[model samples]
Target: MSLTLSLQRSLQQTPARTATIFGTRRRSFREHGDRVARLAAALRSQGLQANDRVGILAHNSDRFLECIMGVWWAGGVLNPVNIRWSVPEIVYSLDDCDTRILIVDKAFAALAPRIGATARHAPLFVYADDGAAPPGMLSFEDLMEQHEPVEDAGRSGNDLACIMYTGGTTGHPKGVMQSHMNLWSAATMRLSETPILRGSTSLHVVPLFHIAGLGRVVMQSIAGECQAVLPGFDAGAVLEIIERERITDTVMVPTMIQAVLNHPDFDQRDLSSWRRLGYGASPSASVMVEQAVQKLPNVELSHAYGLTEACPVISSSGPAHHSEDARKSGLSRSAGHPAFGVLVRIVDAGGREVPRGVVGEITARGPNIMLGYWNKPEETAKALRDGWLFTGDGGYLDADGNLFIVDRIKDMIVSGGENIYSAEVENAIAQHPAVAMCAVIGIPHEKWGEAVHAVVVCKPGAELDEEAVRTHCRERIAGYKCPKTVAFRDALPLSSAGKILKRDLREPFWAHRGSA
Candidate 1:
């Protein structure tokens, strides 16, 4: 069915109930639904035809949620801009998808002019920030005020819903085309596995551009509960919000969980209201999990494992897997069993199904799987083979069908819960004037799960330092994707065919730890 059906149900059943909380501002479902409908009418007035792509460049907010619903309500595909992306990266996505209108907040309003100048067609901008609309742009509030509420477009099934861009293996981001059914299946699948409590208020700290964060938003929408919105993550703010808002449910990456526990005011806060805590996006350390269990004794801790192509949930480990005995047996570290209605398999290089307990590429089949990569048939073909999405992660299934992620077959790094492809970083490093050749790899990091490390061989007569390398990369890519540490090398280890041996480069760092 259509995602808008949830909004309709909320309006009919719980119209007066609080739907969103942002700072001191609150909106009931009736208010939220009205705004969403008006926003939809405004989008149609702006020439948003059925299935047309609309982009949103902003931090997480109530307005962002409304914009997402509004676009879908108007039967348009969403292109949620990644806040971490550089101007070039942002422009590439807009141009690649031909997004005709961009809804931007004050944080990214400055980049609009450059993006407008660069994209194939300059998009009409709708300012969604707190202040007055900037020059030559329409105000978000004015649009809702001017347009009357319209009926939902009722798009469903295989109709495209979102084109979420993820870090690409070949250095440019690939837009993953998710259908309405895919998103619906993803949210419902999670609901079947772990039902949300009635009237539960969930907190939003993660970026809405990511699948995990947006998936939670959709789940909350369907559950018709309250959502406490935040622009971004801050440990102190998170603690204060949870205690202030009485948030009952929330999810975050392991890094965020660790930060919240490590906060100076952790023990002083009244986090007793929080009942369920979900952690994922990166592997969690047992020490962090133990600290969470010990500190928040009443809360339930769960973990999920998936990728963008799966609309993001392939497997989830519930509270049972986080039990004391499970932790001692290392079952807590497993990604848990396959999600309901999902088919997971560990396959060999030739796409042959490998026996359980044998490490291989993780492939998943389900209705939640994305339609395909936007306009990249070859890449899509390689990813979706024989109705199964061949996830580039190397993992194995235990006897109980629990997935254990060992290594990433793709040249990628997950730093602070954000995916950073090594090729993207290496492409930036090789552009440096003093670099002859370079390779990037993930190294063990205490704070971030993994840090981007660059191994470089500068030209024989030229010179380069860590700062120079980092500075150069920062100019080309997002700051997080840049190398956290750079090492000078006479030459990198290579295989027989002259390919750089990245495994050898990562050996010393991961040897004692046992995995990358």
Candidate 2:
């Protein structure tokens, strides 16, 4: 019925089964359940009440998983702090949410003093890192040992569950409020579409603070499967874990997948146990998809497309969509069909549905959609209109009802009179053998209202000039779609989630022109 109930079911059904693996440490369902209950008691003792916000700023670890469960068990809301955020960003979220309790891992303990000093309310700090608790903080292990195990609060349905902060690529991060029903429905609906393998072992490489990673965690818990938690993503380390732990399934962004494929250990590692790979967050190049298919012939690939406001998954492209036949039909490039129990439509600016094959804003409606943005009613009103979450993404549905994402609505380039989707241009650039990664943005032009410009990262030892890049794009796309100027970099700026930061790329050019 709820996330807590799901965990209880798993605990009841498989008390002795392995629940989580972090490095050399392993915990059974019973052990994890007991710790979760005690942690809940500890939080309650520290003044956590129904709907109170508790924060966790940590990397992926068993404690991160426990912190998530413990918050709900204590009848509190979770605000998982972004590990990549600076002290100011972290303070803004905590202050905005009025969080009074924060759990920090060793990697982020240094941030406690700064966050406590700046936040609206100085929070009680619980150190979950290795060794003893630093000065003023409470030790997570000590709390578990000292407190009595408490009963589950039995929170379910519309009860507030989490306030996940967005990446803030556009502006200050807004907390997306997720209810118990929203997250439960999202995990269940996704599983209904792509059933998890029984007794499977999943690896957690993505940050638990993000929707994609946290959503996967909820799904894995509901399935009562084994989870292996990684501190963070390391290409070689991931490969080693797959071989050593016999990880059966995992989720990653396309960029992470590409890194794994490009790793030196990729060819040498014994990864036969790995069966399913789910990727999303950004569009995948056809070339990279081909590389993944070639390198991991036995692995089934799936893609999810959604944003934080939608509880993260509105549609999923399954293994069938990645087949050779589907690839040839261009279905592989599509964001796939609307997810189970979710309604999706491409709507024009007036909120009317656009005809198939016409590009428009992608909107979705479902029980899984967030309650609203936390403490921002006006912004929430703008995002959720007439029961539909108007996703600021430009895309179209094909005749076959497959959704093809073009680009973020804000990222589309209007060159002269033509509308150029950056994804299309970037995809074309990716096809070139020498290009490793690329991001296309619109810049102010004297002749054209906006010019198509590209920032490219070439493959190692690969040389590419601006004209050569333009020539390559011209061969595959229209002249207006080709980049008028190309700048090469050893690497492209990437967000923590592995998405290209186009806002960062566009800032310099637009700043001088005094245009967005």
Q: Estimate each model's TM-score.
A: 0.82, 0.99
lDDT of 1 by residue, 243-275 (tens): 999999899876578668878899999998999
In model 1, the worst 10-residue window by lDDT is 492-501
Give the per-residue lDDT digits (tens) of candidate 2, residues 1-516. 589997899888999999999999999999999999999999999888899999999999999999999999999999998988999999999999999999999988988899888888889999997899999999999999999999999999999999999987667899999999999999999999988899899999989998988999899989999999999999999999999999999998877888999998888999999999998977646778888999999999998999888878899899999999988888899889999999998999899999999999999999999999999999999999999999999999999889899988998899888889998999899999998899999999888899999999988889999999999988999887899999999888887777788888899999877666
Candidate 1: residue 363 Cα off by (Å)? 0.2
Tell how far residue 173 is off in model 1, in angstroms: 0.8
Best by TM-score: 2
Count residue pairs with overlapping backbones in model 1. Answer: 0
- Segments of candidate 2 deviating more than 4 angstroms: 514-516
The 10 consecutive residues of candidate 2 with the worst lDDT sum are 281-290
Candidate lDDT scores, in order, read: 0.88, 0.91
Model 1 segments beyond 4 Å from truth? 411-516
Q: Score candidate 2 by lDDT.
A: 0.91
